[model samples]
Target chain A: MSASTIIFYILSAIIVGGGLLAVTARKIFRAAVFLLFSLIGIAGLYFYMNYEFLGAVQIVVYVGGIIVLIIFSILLTAESGSDMKKPALSRILFSALATIFACALTLWLIKQHTFHVNESTIIEPSVRNIGRQMLSTTEHGYILPFEVVSILLLAAMIGCIVIAIKIKPKT
Target chain B: MVITGVCLLAFLVVLCFFLGYMERKVAAFMEIRLGPNRVGPKGSMQIVADTVKLLFKEGLTPDGADKFLFNLAPFIVVITSMLVVAPIAYARDFQLWDINIGVLYVSSISSMAVIGILMAGWSSSNKYSLIGAMRSGAQIVSYELSIGLSLISIVILSGSLQLSEIIESQANGWWIFKGHIPVIISFVIFIIASTAEINRAPFDLTEAEQELTGGFHTEYAGMKFAMFLLSEYINLFVVSAIAATIFLGGWMPFHIGGLDAFNHIMDYIPSSIWFFGKTFLIIFIIMWFRWTFPRLRIDQLLNLEWKYLLPISMVNILLVTAMAIMGWHF
Candidate 1:
């Protein structure tokens, strides 16, 4: 096999192995750590695909920001030594069914699509192009979505504060 | 590429030795005491002895600790720090991988160190480690805003995220002089934020010895602990080099307007020397801060980032954007 194919297989193994371990791990903290490994594996896949900016974003936002947040909350609420309680049989069966359904859906979709491998049509993804598209006002621009997301985040922040702050009762 | 990787690894080891020794000497000089004078010629071989000792020492994983993760943390920390070294241009023609988004790449990758620390803390099953890791999580998340925004301001001025282009823009004059107020503000904010980012003193709440009892890596022993220490210095070196590259002109020598003769004389010095000289100067300033200031309280630390550095950096970004729009910068 070619080096790229071998590398792709290795990366896929890492992602799958880490994901399996994340779901099956007995300890919550270990599960979280496994989740981190899986996320990093996905970032590695992004790097392998030559999405440098996307790979960096994957690591920074998901591995650095989101995973850290998850671990922080785990540490705050759960004891490190305590393993998660086993799921009920019904719950396990439902989850297994859901997983199989998702896998079948993905496979069906993959079979339905005919992906053309057009080498000439593939444009190199540059940071400048990414930046222009992000801020552009054209039909394909992301400015509106970006602004909406920022506003949504602002609302979330305000809502969190409102919920967190305990108003003193009338004395 | 393999040769460059091996060479950089070698350089990292050698640099860490000197950094460890220099940090001690600086601390000693500040505190009015001699530090490690007997190891070898003013303690030059002290780090060597320490390394040897650590190598032979027992690496223990606590009974309650998760074996895989407990062993994995230090490697993650080291790898993240080393990955950032790729895009940095050591000299004019000396760069490992000059990626398109060099500045953004460094900023993003460097932030991943927190995960290793968090893993180290959580897997250890130690309360002190957990607390330290939690503090680090909050601290990094807060201060990263300032670090990122300050860098954005520089990126705005240079109009390129690539390191080489940014350095080229500073060829005529360093950004600290040419970009004027916004650059100065961003530089100051960057230094402060990055110093905190690396978790040095005055903001080292994570590893606050007296309080947290060695903090996140408290359970780490032998080479594992040593790796953590080494990555800390490597990170300091990387951040300082970036500061020099962005604000002080990477490998470029100082050139005044209408001073062709003087500029030519300055060019006689090798580019690597210019790069390292500026990097070390910034590193010295960071080390100076370590020795001069006491650690801040956890609340105070967060306040410094969110209340002070973040707002200042945001304003600086706006100011820089305006300058960039109006063509006010050199």
Candidate 2:
């Protein structure tokens, strides 16, 4: 394998392994911490793919913001540090089966697609280029989706506020 | 790979002394007292002495903590900081990957610092550790929004995601100058948001000694604790470098129209020095904020992010985007 491919494989392992640890760990805080690592690994992949802005956003937003929120929620809930009870045998078996099924579905989908991007296409990392492409009428312009991202953030903020605010007790 | 490895080692070795020296000097200047004049010319080798002390000290694993993660936390903190430096535009053509998504890469890696904090907090298995970790979670998330909005404004103005492109776009004049009022506004918001994001003073409730008692890493001792301390300074360095690269123009020489000889002279200094000079100036400012301001209450911190900076930056971004489209800027 090429050096880049080898690097890719290693980061992929880290991302996947960290994700599993985040979800499956017995302690809630440990899970949250693992999620942070997983997100960082994915950002590394984005950097390797030449998507610098996306990588930084991934760090600033998801790894930095979202996981931090999760940690806060764990803290506020009062259940963060306790040892969670292991699932009963039958439930554990059922959950394991479900996980396998989900993994299989994803693996099957990955196998079905043959992905390719032209290797000769050169690009600049400038915000100016992205802005131009965004506003352009061609295939590379991403203007429409940019507005969508804004709306989505607006919705997220509203939802977070709603979740955070508990109605005051009636006088 | 070999070069990158060497760079990481060099980064750590330099940071060991610089952070140690900066902390002593800043603390001394803050209180009307002198600090750290004993070791190696104004405590230059103080960190070295400290390192030797920590090296000989015994490693302690507290009872009831998860053994595996406890060991993993410090290394993770150092490694995450190391990884984020890759995409930073050290100078013109001196960056690692000048990718279209450079901004995203930086934003993502920065978040990992929070994870390291979480690890230190939880793995310590103390009540203070838990509280500190929780506070860090809330603080980092809230500050990140304003940080993102401010950065998005830069993306709007520079019209590029690459670090090199961002620096190049400001070649004629730094973004703080060339881009309209909104860019300057965003720069201001960004600096504040980043200071908060990195848990510097005025936003350092996570380590509030009066409250959580050393905050998240309270239970840590020896080299593990040292790693946490080292990571904090490295983070300060990384964030300042980024702010300089994005807003101040990384290693791009000053260019006022019709001043060739002076501008050429400005370019004579090594790119790395120019980069470090700009970065350290910002670092000093951050340190000033730490000493000058008192820590914000957790509620006040969240309110500042949500009710103020976020909204202002969003509006500014819209204005800048419209201006960019209308050809209103140089």
Candidate 3:
């Protein structure tokens, strides 16, 4: 096997292993750590695909921002040393049924569709092109959604502060 | 490339040792006390001795701690810091990988260290460790805003995210002087925000010893503890190096438009020396801040970022953008 293929398999194993551990781990803190590893494995995949910016963003936003936030919340609410309670037998049976359905659906979709490789339209990942597309005003531009997202973020921030502030009762 | 990576790893260890010794000396000088003097030639080998001691000491995992994550945190911290070293320019043409997204890559990877800190704190299962990690989580998130915006101001001025291009743009003169008031504003905010980002004193709510009792790495022992300490010094160096590269010109010497003779004299110095000289100068200033100031309260730390640094950085970026649009910068 080629070096790249070996690396890819290793990364995929890490992603799958971490993901399984994240859901199955008894300890909540360990689950978060597993989730972090899973996210980092995905970042490695991005790097392997030569999408450097996406890889960095995946590390920054998911591993750095989201996982830390999740861990912080877990520390705030949960006892660190305790294991999560086991699910009911009925719930486990339902989850097993859901998983089987998902697997069958995915397999059926894959068998029905014929995938074609299109090498001609693939663009090399570069910051300049990303920046231009981000701010451009044409049909393919992302400026409108970008501004809308900024406003959404602002609204969320204000909402958080509003919810956090405690109101006083007057005599 | 392999040789360079190995050399950089070796250099990182030596630099961490040197910075540790320097910090002790500086702290001693500030407090009017003699620091370690009996180790090896005026305590120069103090850090080495400490490392040897730590190596021989048994690694400990606290009873109730998450063993795997507790062990993994230090490695994550060290790895993130090491990843940042690749894109930074030590001298002209001396960078390992001059990636197109150098600034973004550095900022993103450096932020990942916070996750490691959080993991260390949470997995320790100690209340103090959890508090320290939570403080770090809050502080880094808030400070990252101003740090990123301040950097974007510079990116707007230079029209590139690449460190080499940013450094190249400052060849005529440093950005602090040449980019005028807005650059100076961003530089000041950048320094303050980055100092907080790395969780140094005056903003080190995470490891506030008086309050948190050694903070996030309280449960860490032996090599694990040493790794955390090593990453801190490396981070100090990395932030200062970036400040030097972005605002003070990476490896470029002092120059002026009409001072050809003076510029020629400054050019006699090697690029690596110039880079390290400026970086160490910034590091010294950061160290000075640590010794000279007291730690801020957790509330004050958040207020300082959200109330002060963030707004100023946002405005500074707007001013910088206007200048860039009007073709006013160097």
Candidate 4:
């Protein structure tokens, strides 16, 4: 096998292993860390595909932002070292069945789709090109979606502040 | 690639030692006290001796601690710091990796250091370490927003995330001088935010000795503890080097728009010297900050970022964007 293919396999192993460990680990903190590894492995996959920008965004948003928040909440609420309560046998069996079904459905979908690699249309994922395309008003421009995302983020921020604010009782 | 890795490791070790020595001397001068004058002529060998001592000392994992993670934490911290060194332009045409997403890579990778801190804190099974780690986590996450925004202003000014391109765009003049008020504001914010991001005083509530007693690495002893200190100094260097590269023009010699003779004279100095001089100047400024300012309260620290730095930086980006589009920057 080519070096790239070997590397891809290794990355996939890390992602799958980390995901498995995250779900199965008894310790809450260890599970969070495994989730972090799984997320980082996904970021590595993006980098492997030569999508440096996407890889960085993946790291920044997922591994750095989301995982930290998850860990923060875990630290605040849970006994990190204590073993998590085991699920019922029925629950585990159901989850396993659901996972297998989901995997089969995903595989079938992938097999059904005829993927095309459009080499001529592929743009260099440079920062300048990204910036231009993101803000452009022309066809294929991402301005509208970008603005929508920003608005969504702003709304989310306001919502968070609203939820977090303490209401003083009447004196 | 292997040779580059080896050299970078060597450079990191030497730089950390120098920074440790410099911090001691600077603190002493600031406090009007003699510091470390005993070991090898003005205590230049103090850090070396300290390292040797650390190497000999037994690294203890606290009873009931998670041994695997406790050992793993320091390596993660060190590796994250080392990874950031890749994109930083040390001298003209000298950098390990000139990745297109250099700024983003640095920010993203550096953000991972918090995980290591959290790991160290949690695995130690000590309340102090956990508290320190949590404080560090919050501080880094909050300050990261301001750091990213401030950096975005520079990226907007240069119109590229590439380190070399950013430096090249500053050929006529550095951003701090040429980009006027908005750039200057971002530069100041960058310095402050980055200082907090790296957990330096007066923003160092993470390791506030009076409260947490060495904070996240309280239970760590010997070389493991030394690794944390090493990572801190390396991070300090990386942050200052970034400041130098972005605002002070990396390895670019100081130049004027019209003064040909003086600019030519400035070029006679080596690019590496220019880079190091600018870096150290910023480093000294950061050190001066550590000694001069009192450690801020946790509430006050978070307030500074969320209330002041974040809002100011957000507005500053808009101003920079306008300036960039208008061709207002010289």
Candidate 2 lDDT by residue in tens digits, B1-330: 688768866865686578668877887898878888888887777878888898778778888777777888888887777777777877667776555667766776677777777777877888898888878877876787777788877877777777887888887888877786888898899889999888889889899998889998787778888787777887888889889988888887766767988878887977778888899889888988988888889899889988999889889989888888886876
TM-score of 4: 0.95
Rank the candidate models, highest TM-score first: 1, 4, 3, 2
Q: Each candidate's chain B TM-score? A: 0.98, 0.95, 0.98, 0.99
For model 2, report DockQ: 0.58
Comparing candidate 2 with candidate 3, which one achieves the higher lDDT? 3
User: Which whole-number lDDT from 0 to 100 does residue B173 have in model 1?
Assistant: 93
* Interface C-alpha root-mean-square deviation, candidates in order: 1.0, 2.9, 1.1, 0.8
Off by over 4 Å in 2: A1-12, A15-24, A33-62, A102-171
The structural similarity of chain B in model 1 to the true chain B, as TM-score, is 0.98
Q: Write the per-residue lDDT of candidate 1 for residues A53-161, one digit (tens) a residue.
A: 9998998889878888888888788565677789999999999999999999999999999998998876678888887878888887878688799999989999999
User: What lDDT tens digits, residue by residue, belong to model 3 across residues A1-171?
Assistant: 999999999999999999988878998888888888899999999989888899988988898789878887887885666888998999989988998899899999999999999888977678888877788888889875887899999899999999999899787
> Candidate 3, DockQ to 2 decimals?
0.74
lDDT of each: 0.91, 0.80, 0.90, 0.92
Judged by whole-model lDDT over C-alpha atoms, candidate 4 comes out at 0.92
Weakest ten-residue segment in model 3 chain B by summed lDDT: B150-159
lDDT of 3 at A39: 92
Better of 2 and 4 by DockQ: 4
